[model samples]
Target: MMKKYVCQYTIIRFLPYVETGEFANIGILMAAINQPYFGFEVIPSKHHGRITNFFDQLNKDTFRETVKVLRDELERVKDNIDFQTPNTSNYQDVAKMIFENIVANKETIVRYSDPRVLITNDPAKELDKLYKRYVERDFATKPHNDQVLEKGIREILQLNHLNKQFKQAKVGDKRFEVRFPFVKRMDGEPLKIIKPLHLRDKEPTKIREHGGTWWQKFVQLQDLNLLPEKVLVPYVGPLANDDSYDACESIIEKIRGLDIEVVQTSEESRILEFAAE
Candidate 1:
């Protein structure tokens, strides 16, 4: 039997006002002493409505910026812990230091709940479980099919050693903002927008709606001349004889018509060729 390790974690909360003492759980931080594991997960900025509603006076842009800074700090702490060759302190001590440094003296009140201990074989998995239970439960409903597609696509990117090149990117003029899920970049190559189209919804209407939205955006970007020079869309074809597949096909055609590249996720050679170029 695999031995379970003890993991300590705290829920990070954002308090709009310290006097009122009300707060919203925004993230989680976990540390496993014996395993020497440290990690963190934060609520995405897109799902910050609860924070806004909780604090009517809060500046939404400022709050989001602050959260981004805090996340960067957390990443720095994780890197330090991971690369620490000759660590002088214990894991618990390092965890506490990270928590305190992040929460110390910011305009918005950020605090962590009392550290709680749990026994788990995989600390990272436990962190995700807790995050989904607490923070994600209050956020938007993400389709399970989309989640699976994202995971699968990420695996492909990782296997090809191209994961680091892809990142969230925004491209547009001041008047409009277009967010791409993944943008691949290399020193000498033009930016490549890679989006995994999720069209496996059970409802045909939903699939059509999703497709329509992307089609509209493509048209708008074309009109504005804001479309990227290279766009790669990976799509999983729908089930055979399914009406929804028709809608999915329509979207793929629309994307192709816009001069964007489309490839099946299974087309490893094609994807790697694109990545290499």
Candidate 2:
């Protein structure tokens, strides 16, 4: 029979304005009962989506500070678990104590939910499972997934030592604006704009619709004469089945017609070359 261990877990939340009673799930903490297993995962402020948007009306500085404090404290506790071999005889109590300690009542922006219990064979994987279930689910990953795609492209650029040349920017004239994840400016004017297009979808229509949104943005930018000298769009597409090929090709054609450069994500060389230039 496979050994099974019970774990106590809590969902970490950020309560920016306590009066509003609005709290966002920002992380998860877990500890195994009867076993020396403890782990945690917190959504980094940079990777946070809805929480950052929620902070718009609130103070960004306070949000970040609170998140850092919570993460730091969690890390400190987790390290102690590693240093001291938790007594197996009392580990069940230790797990509950730790969970309760973390969720204790406090006036801070950080808060935790009531303790929940689960049985798992792997503590590390279960911690990740809880984070995704509690944190990512609360944010709704539709657009968040698109942001994740853009984030990956950013990591690729940073790895190639070409990230410094571009920065997040709004490219448009005074009357209109569209945000691009990576942009190069010339004389304070939008010079080269690089955007990651996430076109991978279960349905082809959804893919085309997303592409159309960007296509319209490009058209308006060109009409305003604010279009960058060069636009590099690295897209992920051509779904596994044959049905998506036509939609993918059509969208690519539509984007390319605006005199914009479109590169499939598989073409890493092209992306690096565009950024390097």
Candidate 3:
């Protein structure tokens, strides 16, 4: 039987920017009526920056709201007091239901210049495709997250010049938790893990080695914040000749310096068991 969900979506586009016959494309989406609209615009022409920026804000807002709704639904299932039987099969079902709900809720977040510009279809497969497209089109862009993190790190270093302010300020006190990217299953709910564990890494050496083409090699983290309950990050000991020691040491220092408690492990067996569950 075909499954149904309670939400819908819409997508609309403006003409591509033209500069020296070159055109840039930008897409934007707004989630929920109350949240600010956001977007990203591609300016094919230098003079089109205004248009692109407008769309960029719209795109960002839509992405933000999408994340919020997705998280809320995951929590709902996680907190279900009526949950009884929990198993792999049931988990898969709940996961599917959550993905569908994301699709249904897409319309709520997408903001169109024209209210008529909306997309609607069955929540089952279409939602999955929409999410994949959103991730590919927006979140996969490297400069966004990496650049943001870099700037944040720079600020941290600069603030250290003033030991007083640095001590008073916090490092990721509110944002330090490890995040899971896209679509996770709750204890009593069923949702298929759409992406694998390896794809969640900050680096892409493995993806490149796997013969993923240039585009395919570009992996983005699924929303870790969407995971229900606690997050388990599995790490292996650093390689003998690699800079793993420095990287891990730096990470450890940062956490400790920030007074954050994080567990470090090298147990492949335990990691595998948790992922499988």
Clashes of each: 0, 0, 38
Query: What's the best-to-worst order under TM-score?
Result: 2, 1, 3
Cα lDDT computed for each candidate against the true fold: 0.70, 0.76, 0.31
Clashing residue pairs found in predicted model 1: none
**Candidate 3, superposed: residue stretches over 4 Å from native:** 1-183, 187-228, 240-244, 252-266
Model 1 clashing-pair count: 0
Q: Give per-residue CA lDDT, model 1, range 40-139, as digits (tens).
A: 9998776666667544456788678768877898898788776773355575567656655554544557787767889998888999999986567533
**Model 1 stretches astray by more than 4 angstroms:** 1-144, 185-190
For model 2, residues 64-166, the per-residue Cα lDDT tens digits are 7777888888888776766664555665566567777778967677887878889988888888987886678656744565688788788889999988889
Candidate 1 structure, TM-score to reference:
0.47
Better of 2 and 3 by TM-score: 2
lDDT of 3 by residue, 197-275 (tens): 2212233332221112111111111222322332333223244455434544444343334322233343434433444
Q: Between the candidate structures 2 and 3, which one is better when assessed by lDDT? A: 2
- Which 10-residue window in model 2 sums to the lowest lDDT? 48-57
